[model samples]
Target: MVTLRLIAMAALSFLAASGAHATEVKCKGNEAMLTRYLGMFDEVFNGRKLDRIAEYTSEDFQPHDSAPGTPKGHEAIRLLVTNMAKSFPKRKLTNDLIICGGDMVVAYQTVEGINDGPLFGGIPATGKSFNFNWIDICRFKYGKVVERWGAGDALGMMTQMGFKLTPPSAEAK
Candidate 1:
């Protein structure tokens, strides 16, 4: 019995020293709030209501993504959307699924569009179309999206656009 108690104490002390602890994120709010928030997200992103972006996003919004500039702030987000509209005028940010918890929302998105103008890194339009999947996570505060992170199927889209990942020959190089 003494040995068992000593082992348990030692283990607890080691755990405390190592600082290996798990954090549980609990939503202080309700799921309906998240649903409505996601609805607003989709509406602003897809409905071409750039002017209403202020309503859905906080003034100091921070947006992180694979986009070239890693857009941050409200105006940056607006610019990012405007640039996408230029590339694929008919592009749609279709939300396939949304999960909410702990002041955050994760959205599974299917963005379908055609490359009618420059798409990425000043690359000219290939006039091709693609459907890419994205997983976006947003942190909300006061019912506004304050921070966001998103990852999209960029490689797949580039492949569909006929972008070869092959290395050029010595002569081409």
Candidate 2:
């Protein structure tokens, strides 16, 4: 009876191990999905192709920034991009670093542009140019980007555009 019990336990252990291995294999991240997401960033920023957002983002896509509200869905993202482009007509984004792990990608980039257009973030453009860095963390599920979190130096950009929080001290006459 003891020998029979040992054999049955070993068989069960083998089955469990095989099941775990199968699940791990199935849950692996798809490289093609990662590549597509990276490419989408290029198209959106460099090519200014806002329409391509729908192709890479999920129907329920959500983007979170340091700002209070979140932008949801492809249409919202498109509108956000359009407004940003209008605010900085000569804006350029350069990817400084891109790292992908599992199903998440983190991108570090720098944006350079002239603030020569209408005001953004309550700060009017002063026709001044500035460069700012930002970091974005994006997650993909089932080959589509489902979520993103972005943060950058909004105050610094405003400062560069000559918007000072405190009134400048009058120069000594």
Candidate 3:
């Protein structure tokens, strides 16, 4: 028992010296932060209210996983939502789970839609329907999202939309 206690003490001391700490995952539901997070989907995505982008995002917003060449700040989100809306006019975004910890909120969501309009401003509509799952980690400051990280099944959605992927030729390799 004495040896076990000494070992535990030593481990604790080592962790303290290494600055190791537990992450707090306290969910803060019904708060303004969570409210705004959900509201972004409702008002911006579902409602197609691009003007309200500033209402939900900070001026210096940064979406770490935005498409290559997408400008930072609220414009990135605007461009994203606009393209998605054009590609999937009747899309519905639903949050399956939302977790809030401190100033960060994580959302697991799904988007269901039919490709009834032009995609990426040019690709013809496939008239195909698809459902894709995605996740987002948003950091809020002053009731606005200042930073975001997200990933989704773009390849899966494309496959569902009848898009084919071709392998490179041996000569190219």
Top candidate on TM-score is 3
Per-residue C-alpha lDDT of model 2 across residues 1-173, encoded as one tens digit per residue: 75675466456445543544221112235557557766887787566698788877899998787355645788667876788887888776766666678888777776767777787556566887666778878898877789888888878777766666754465332
lDDT of 3: 0.79
Tens-digit lDDT string for candidate 1 (29-80): 5666576565666667777678888888888998876456665678866886
Candidate 2: C-alpha lDDT = 0.71
* Candidate 3 residue pairs that clash: none
Q: Name model 1 segments beyond 4 Å from true.
A: 1-29, 66-71, 168-172
Clash count (model 1, backbone only) = 0
- The parts of candidate 3 lying over 4 Å away from their true place are 1-26, 170-173
TM-score of each: 0.74, 0.72, 0.78
User: For each predicted model, how many residue pairs clash, with residues at least 3 apart or on different chains?
Assistant: 0, 0, 0
Name every residue pair that clashes in candidate 1: none
